[model samples]
Target: MKILVIRRDNIGDLVLTTPLFRALRQRFPEARIDAFVNSYNAPVLAGHPDVDQVHEYTKGKHRKGFSPGWLERLGQMWRLRKEHYDHVVIATPGVHPRQIRFARFLNPAHITAFVPPGWKMFGVDQPVEYLGKDRHHLLMTYRILLPFGIEGDPPAPRIAFTPPAHSPGEAPVIAIHVSARKPSSRWPEERYAELMRALHERHGARFRLFWAPGAENDARHPGDDGRAARILASAAGLPVEAVATNELEGLIAGIAACDAIVCSDGGAMHLAAAMGKPVVCFFGESEAHLWHPWDVPHRLLQPESHDVADVTVDEALAAFDALRQEANAA
Candidate 1:
């Protein structure tokens, strides 16, 4: 049997779908398992062991980089139509009519997707009931796999990257990601710097600061260049290195190297979880229970105001300290 897992979503959504890849490989060990991912999140599956191949295409919005403008994606879809996949799993939660229509265009023999309870999808050969938004997103995503008789306790999403070996006696390296798309999720720059100093003084920890690389005013991909700059200046005389990453791969590699990570709720937090690093994540207006780092010893520093800026530096430090204890005990 041949299978294709379609997860053309954001970086974190694709990361969470990784467990589906592993489950597919285990259930059908001899079957070929491929992925349909966009260029933005393709790097997450770059070297995954269970994934046989990745069909990558560029999305239209990020047109500055490559040929994902329009005609190219159509041509890519034409190629997929020729592959004749036995099963195509649309790895997304809830109803996505656009993606469902695209799945029909692929002309796969079978499609597994989540449909609304009373709605009918035209080409969905196997439909999983989307009860409601109650469980973690990963658990909701796993519903797409029930047709294959694989159920219960999906494995932690697997990332096929290794951290560079470090000396046991060296101070632990904590990664800080200052980029968050939502204003509610962003912690103040001075607070991040102060938290860094506190962590260093308390645990002798070095820091690697990671952020999206672009001007803050860039409307296409508004980055935290100014925030990163201010934080670095505020936390001078400390061992903090700003990791410049123009792509998702660079961010993933930087996170893989860290002993732990501090970031607001976004792709970086999910990447940290995939890397198996302890996390002290800030959850603001987003759904805290639905999106917390999965199967990891971590703390979510979400204040009553639902703004990360309201979470104090001392609160962040204490959260990380508690996480460290939990991680060590585990």
Candidate 2:
């Protein structure tokens, strides 16, 4: 049997869907399992052992206002139709109509998806209701396989990146992901610098600042470049180094090299969790229960004001200290 799982979303979302791939492979040991993801997130699934193939959809290049890239999308659809998949699972929490239409084109024998609330859908062999409160996304994505008796607390997100050659360096090297697409979720740069200094003094820990290139060019809200620079300048005498990468794979490699991560609630945090590294995550306006580091020893610091900037340096240091204690205990 052949199975295709579609989860065309961001890095964090793709990471959350990994357990579903594992479940499918476990249930059908001899089946060929493939994943369909967006180009930006394809690297997360590229070297996955459970997935036989990784199909990338370049949404940015192909999507426009109303029409989108109909010609290219249709051509890709035609190719998928010829794959003769035995089962197709729409592994996203909320299934979009366009994705539903695409699944139809695959002509799979069994179709499964999570149907949004208050909308009826036809042609799906199995449909699970989306309940997005308190529940983590890893468990949420695994619900799509309920009809096949694959039900449990899904395994944590795991990735298979070729671990970079071990470099003998400072112990407990902490990576600080200093960017968030949402401003509310971004802790102040000066505060981050303070946390770094504190960690360095307390544990002799070195720091790595991780940020995506062109993040400062985002028209919606441009500030990451300035933040990265500010962090470096503030840590002038400290052992803090900035590590920026344009490609997802490069970013993964950089994160893999770190012993742990201090990041906002975003892709970098999820990546660190997949790599089985302990994390100190700052949550602002984002939901903590749903998106916190999964199955990893970590501490999540949230502000009462609901703004990441309101989370004090001392508070962050305390969290990091707690994370270190947990790591040491283990």
Candidate 3:
């Protein structure tokens, strides 16, 4: 049997979907599993062992209404139709009409999607209801496959990536990712520098900064490189090294090398979790309960005012300390 898992969303969402692929592979060991993902997030699934193929849907200049991109999308759909997939699973939060239409276009023998309460949709072979209360997003993705008799504890997100060459002997390396597409989710630069200084003094930890280019397009302040420069300047004479990666694959490799990570609620945090590294995350606009690092030793610091900037340096330090303690205990 062949299966197609559709999760054309952000990097973090795709990361959370890894376990579903594993569960499917475990249940049907011989089945071929293909993933349809957004081009930007394709790297997250590039080397996943459970996935047989990774198909990318690029939304570029042709993405506007009635453009050349629609033809490309249609052409891709035509190719997918020829695959004769046995099942197609839409692994997203809610029932997206566009995705639903795409699922129908594939004409798979079985169509399964996550639907919300009171949602009535036609053509879905199995409609899984999303449990929003006290459920992690990773488990939510696994719920979609429950009808297929995939029972047992869901696997955590896993990635197979070569770690970049970096060594900090006898000193723990903490990675700091200072970029968030949402301005409200970014903690202040001064606070980040202060936290770095505090961690360095307390644990003699080495700091490695990770940032993606073009991050300033959506950020309120400067992008990742700019933020890294500012933090280094503010906390002068500190053992902080700025690591810049042009691609998601490079960022994943860098994060895989870290002992722990301090990041906002975004793709970097999710990447760290997939690497099985402890994390201390700052949450502002995003829901901490649903999006926090999954099944990893971690601490979350959220601002009372719902702005990441309101999360103080001391609070972040405390969370980092707790994360260190948890990591040590484990």
- Among the numbered candidates, top lDDT falls to 1
For residues 1-330, what per-residue lDDT tens digits would candidate 1 score against the true structure?
Answer: 889899998998998999999998999999999999989999999899999999988777776765446788789889998899999898889788898888889899999998888777899989998987788988989878999999999999778778858987788999999888888998887888898999899899999999878898988878878888988999999999999999888888888989999999998898889888899998889998789999888999899999888998888989999998897788
User: Residue 188 of model 2: what lDDT?
Assistant: 81
lDDT of 2 by residue, 1-330 (tens): 989999998899999889888888888989999988888899998778899999877775435466556576678888988999988889888666777778988899988887866656876877777776638777777788898899977877889875545456546788999888777888887887788888999998888888756656777435467678878998889998788777788889889988889999999899999999999888888888788889999888888877888888888888888888887888
Worst 10 residues of 2 by lDDT: 162-171
**Backbone clashes under 3 angstroms, per model:** 0, 0, 0
Q: Which has the better lDDT: candidate 1, or candidate 2?
A: 1
**lDDT of each candidate versus the true structure:** 0.89, 0.83, 0.84
Sorted on lDDT, best first, the list reads 1, 3, 2
Off by over 4 Å in 3: 61-67, 116-120, 131-134, 163-169, 215-222
Candidate 2 local Cα displacement, residue 35, angstroms: 0.8
Q: What number of backbone clashes does candidate 2 have, counting pairs of residues 3 or more apart or in separate chains?
A: 0
Per-prediction TM-score to the true structure, in the order listed: 0.97, 0.92, 0.90
